[model samples]
Structure formats: C-alpha cells, structure tokens
Target: MGQFKVIVVGAGPVGLVLAIALQKSGIDFVVVEQRKQVPPPTAFGIFLWPHILRIFHQLGLYEDMQSIGQVMTKLENRSSTGEHLEISNSFELLEFAHGYPTMLFDRRTFAEVLMKNLKRSDQLVKTNKKVTNITTRKDGVTVDFADGTSERGSIVVGADGVWSTVRDFMRERAPPGLFSEGPNPFIAPYQGLFFRVPRPESLKPGQTVYVHQPNKQLMALVTATEAHMTTYERVPDVSERTYFSPNKVTDEDVKYWFDVPVNEQITFKDLWDDKVMGGKVNHDEGVIPWWHWDRLVLVGDSVHKVECSMSPFRGAGARCGIEGVISLVNKLNRTLNSNPDPSRQDLSRAFTAYQVEREPAARLWVHVSRLDIDLYTSKAGPASKAATFADGRTIPIVANSPVLDILPFPDEKEGVVPWRRHPKADGQSKDVKARL
Candidate 1:
C-alpha cells in the first residue's frame, strides 16, 4: 500500500474540518475515528463567531447554516432579581472583525452539514478504527489501531478528543508519566439535567434567559428553534449513599429542585422519560494540560475541558481546530518548498513552529474558559455579586490591542499568501469605468 501523506485521528468537528481543508489544499490525508457512527441527541448548541462563519462560507456552508440556525442579534446578562446588568449586540461589534454575523446552531446539525459535504469524498474518513499506538521512525510515523491494523504516514494529527492516544504516545517521550491536577476548587459532582423543551412562553424569542438562585443553583434557558434548558446544582459528596446518582438524575430529583407539582405535562419524568432524554451527570473540576513531544498535537476538549459558562460562544473550539490545521499545514508547506532533501532537523523545526504558534493561544483560552466558570458558579457573596456585575459589562481590558487579534496575512513578495480576495469581487471592479 502507498504511504499516506497524513493521518488525522478523530472524526469530530475539528478533525472533519481539518480533513476538508487538507483536501481543498490538494493534500492526501485520511481521518480515523473510533466511533461507529456520528453521535445523536443533538449533544448541545454551538455559537459560531465571525471567523468560524467565514470558514463555513469558504466551504459553501454559510447559506446552508443561515437557512437552519438562528442569527443571535443581542446578548443580555442579568441578575436573578431581573436587573439587566449588561447588554451588547455582537452583530454590531464583531461584524467589523469578521464579515459575517454570529450564529447559533445545534451541534448535530452542524456535524451533519460537515458530513454532507464530506460524503462527496469517499474514503476521506474511516470510522470504527481506533488508534491504539503511534511510533515515530526516521522517515515518518506508524499508527496501530485496536483491530491490529497499522498505517504509516509522514505526519499524524491528533484531532482526537481529550484522551487522545496520539498525545499519549508523544507524552511517553517526555518525563515519564507527568500529569497535572484539576484547576477548580473541588465541588461535589454537578448533576445536570438537559432537555429540549417546547419554547417556554415566559422566555422571549432570540434571547437567553438565565435564572440564578444564590448558592442554590443556576438554570439557563437558551432560545434556539426550541428552548434548550439545563439545570445544574452541586452535590456535596458523590458517595453511594447520596440520594441522587451522578450517572443519571431521575425525574424525582428534578421535582425536588424546581419545587413544582409533578403533572403529566410539567414533570421532569415526562421530559427525560424518552430514551433520548436523561442520563447521569458526571463530576469534573479541572482543565487538564495538553502538550506533547515531536510531531503530535492536541486540540479542542482534548486539550481542556470545563463546565459550560454563560459565554454563549462555541466557536472557540472551531477556532482551535483552524489554528492547529493552519499551523501544521503552513509548516509542512514551508519545509516541502525550501528543502529538496529535508532532514530530521527540518521536520523538527516545523513541529517546533507549530507548538510555539499554537500553545500560548490554547493555554490562554483554557484560562479564560475556566475563569468564566469560576465567576458564574461562585456562591452568594460579595465575590459572587462582583462577578454578576462584571458579567454584564465589557471592560476595555486591552487599551492598545485586542486580547485576540487575527494575524496579518503572510507577505505576498515572499511567495506566501494565507488569504486571497474573492475573484468575482476583483473582476467586478474591472467592469467599472475609469475615473476622470
């Protein structure tokens, strides 16, 4: 069999997007995923920022998304007492940064769209193939799967989720078994119950309603085509003796929290009784550090995991995927263009560039995501009050430059162009009469 140019592990959003990008660049690659098929139950919703929307446009999916998802026009933060603390319309501010408006979409639908485009490229993705081991040689890397199958590639991209086998392989090359502890203060397992209930009449359309009871709990009603409600409360200890199971909270648990009479229509039992509805809520309290040795990288939740904060932005993960793909591809392109007979040193340099460019951004995002969680979940106190107030306001923290800025396009004189103007738009200008 011919040597594969690149092997991407995981068929999640990041891996799929990377595969499409590679295909567009005329690169030979394969995506291997452990799952037999795409997951169901519309895991959750994702808010796509402008940069992410630009990507969808590039893939000819922007219009398709607009047809399905809701365009989020405003973001409002309020206290439990119903006082509006802060309000901003991202459509007005972020439009200047990215050409498109921010969008909210169901995760399952987003994945389906990506898969629809990928269906045209048969053999681009292989499912039910789990990577068990990866070994780097003088020339390239060899990937061994759970089924005793092996494949070799010049490079392996670990788009796999947090527990990545590729990252594990590279970690083995580092100081033996180094692992970091959890970041957040240990809280009891947070049991969460999520349901796509009919749009509650009390909730306004196109708005996200959050109800927080000091020290008791937080419930967020996100308005989508349907109302997506999630109720979270911290459990003191998760021993077997607890009244509720972390694995799955029952309808009775929901009744106790809401303190509402169980009716045929209003009961949590009715809500999660469907096979698709209810499950145990696991406890997690940390953002795990993600780093690896030569020739391997991690992205998305595979790098950091945290509870959902009120940020209402899901494009961050997509942005990480885009950064990883561009960093690795640009390095590979540079090496191939510069060296006719590239040595190991050349490959190492490329890998170093990838790490240097992407690691800081990855770490910063982890910090920001964690901070958001801490503020939202803090118990009722002066600290919590301050956090609540701060949530509504956008402080100009960066006086000089924005905390996040898109990098400038590479110099054209250097024979590198990271972006190009639309040819149609360019040609349209030529049709105009010359000015006197």
Candidate 2:
C-alpha cells in the first residue's frame, strides 16, 4: 500500500472508540455505519466493568463517565414471584477487586460522548454506508458501499459486525480448517426479550434486581429515572444460533414466552406492556479461529460472540472489540516504527498477536456466562440453590484474584498487564501510561 490509511466498516461503540483513538494519534482512518444517522441509542444500558474503565481512562474519558453515569452498588436477587432471594454487593465487590465502581450509562449517552470528543470531523464517520463488497488487491483493499460508491485503504477492518460483509473478503485467503464461521462451538441454551421501561417508584436507584424461575428470568437495572429490563427463558437451540438481522425478530415472535412471572407486581406480559423499547435477539456465543486473512481483520461481534448477560459488562462484546482495536493498533505501531509501513508479513504477525492475546480471555468470559445461564435455568433443586449461594460467596473472591492468573495472555511485557480485576499498584495503569 502506498499510503497507510485504515478503512473501518461500522461505527458501533467499538468502532467509534477505535476511530477516536486513531484520531487522537493523528492517524488516517475513516469509519462507516449502515444507519443513516446517529439514532437514539437502544434502551439497553452499557455497564463498563473495571477493566474497560481503565481503557476509557487511557482514552481520557473516564472522569467524564464517572460524572454522568449511574454507579451501581448492589445487585438484588429474587424469585419469579418477588420472594427475595439475596442481595449481593456487586459494585462493592468490583470496587474491592479493582479500584473503581461498576458504572451504568445509557448506550446513547456513551455514543454521543465519543462522537463529541472525537478529534475527526463528523463527516469522517460516514453513515448509511452499508458495505456491499470488499475487494482486496495486491496494493490495497477497496470497500464498495450499497450506493455505488467505494473507498480504498491500505487495510479494511471488518468491524461491521456478526453479519459482516468484510468477512467475505477473506474467504479465498482463509487457511484450511480456519473458516470464521463453522461448527459453532458456542450455543444458545436460552432466548429472551429485552426491554426498556420507566423506572418504577418502588425500585431503588442504581440498584439492579434479578428475578428467576427455573425456565424463565427477569433482570432490571434501576436508574434515577428509568429502568432497563430483560427477560430470558430456557429455549431449545435453533439450528442457526445468531440473529443475523433485526427483521429476524418481531413483536409477534416474542409473545411465545410472555406469561412467565417476573415479580409480584409484574409478569413478562406486564413488563412488555409497560416497555418503552424492546426487541427479541438470541444470545448466541462463539469464538473464531481465523480472525484475519491477508488484509482483512475483524473487530467486535464479527469474530467473537460472547454469551449474553443481563449485566452489560458480562456480555463482554464492546470491551472485547476495544481490546482488539488496541492490540492490533499497538502491534501495527511497533511494525510501522521499524518500517515506514508494514508488509503483508508484518500485518499477519500483528493480527496473530491480537487473536492470541484475546482468545483466552474471551473463552473465559463465555465459559462463565454459560455457567450463569445454566445455573439460572437449571432446576432450582436444593443442591442447585446451594451452588448458587456458593457462587454468590465466591464472586468477590474470584474478582479479587489477578485476571491474568486465570486467562493468561501470550505476551505479558514488563509494566503492562493484559487485564486484571486486581493488579499490583506499582504496575496498575501501565498500559494506559504507555499509550497516553
């Protein structure tokens, strides 16, 4: 490639964060989104776990987030009929494990903040640009939009997401037995409707409540003025797990699981009735072996789909994508420092490093999330109840442990940790310091 420019397809949270980071570095990059404009973000709340918060701190937005986001201190549990189960100091546990509280912010607020502070001009974030084709040549990659327009860059990133067209660009280059989509290692053992509704007067602010039945569940996050809720039920796995499009789901389709009891005051139907925003999406999970082939690299839901969770942080989608972006970019920076621009081999090394460092952590999150789904949907027999209680007691202990201890990264350099729930104070924020 003659010039070092990055063409990023999709302007999701992860993509925007990458764009912002690139803009701050004065790198040449363009972001494309399929939507025509920034819409009011969906009602889901994005919970930034401690690990991701440190990433934001490096991005220079942590303090700003702390000021605007709601801080969660506890997660209360109950039976489907509103019988109280137990309350755990979830936020406190995270704080004890890391040095920061888990914060809850509307997805829309986060998007706006990223867009506002991005050093690039608004036009740099293109909209209504659905990528139709990706053509990689000896020199560079060309991205064709639905509007008969195209852009070329040194490399095209498939940040476009799960149904990513950029992923198709690598089909010819993909190594044997390394197709990005294949026998899905991850499966959906549950499905549900997620909703956003007004916060109830009776619910405590900044507190999360989870109501569960053997085959049904309800989770709500109460803010100062609104609530975001989701209800999941034990559903047999579909042959095709991921919901490829919004059109795949509809209001009529969501009614099948509508009668499950959520609380004394509300059932699934009642929750749906009061919902201001809602949608049905399957919680599919998987990890891809071929994250990159030749010039194409994936970010976000394209290559790795984490288990769905009522707690936003647990899904680990956005945070993982951000990690991918940082890892890829840092590797590229090292390569570029040695050469004006990297060759194909250099790009391959970077992509490999990105996947190697991230794969184990992604697997760990999905494994734990699967356990969560199993525990919630399993027959609530006395033994199961005891296990749930045991888990509640162990969550903090697990959180307090060093993250790298469990999910080891391939290349752990001095002064930088891959990710830690609790890090040695001396090495804390080492990555942030180096990047900033």
Q: Which candidate is the best by lDDT?
A: 2
Q: What does candidate 2's lDDT look like per residue over 190-221, in tens digits? A: 77766787776666778887777777666888
Ten residues in sequence with the least summed lDDT for candidate 1: 397-406
Question: What would the per-residue lDDT of candidate 1 be over residues 73-187, giving only the tens digit for each residue?
Answer: 6555545444545555644455543445666677688778777777454477777888878887777778898989887776778888645667667666656545433222223
Model 1: residues with Cα > 4 Å off, grouped in runs: 1-4, 39-41, 76-92, 177-193, 201-205, 215-224, 231-247, 252-256, 259-290, 306-310, 313-315, 339-344, 381-436
Model 1's number of clashes is: 3
**In model 1, which residue pairs have backbone atoms overlapping below 3 Å?**
162-302, 247-280, 248-280
lDDT of 1: 0.53
lDDT of 2 at 329: 66
TM-scores of the models, in the order given: 0.72, 0.83
Local distance difference test, per candidate? 0.53, 0.66
Clashes of each: 3, 0
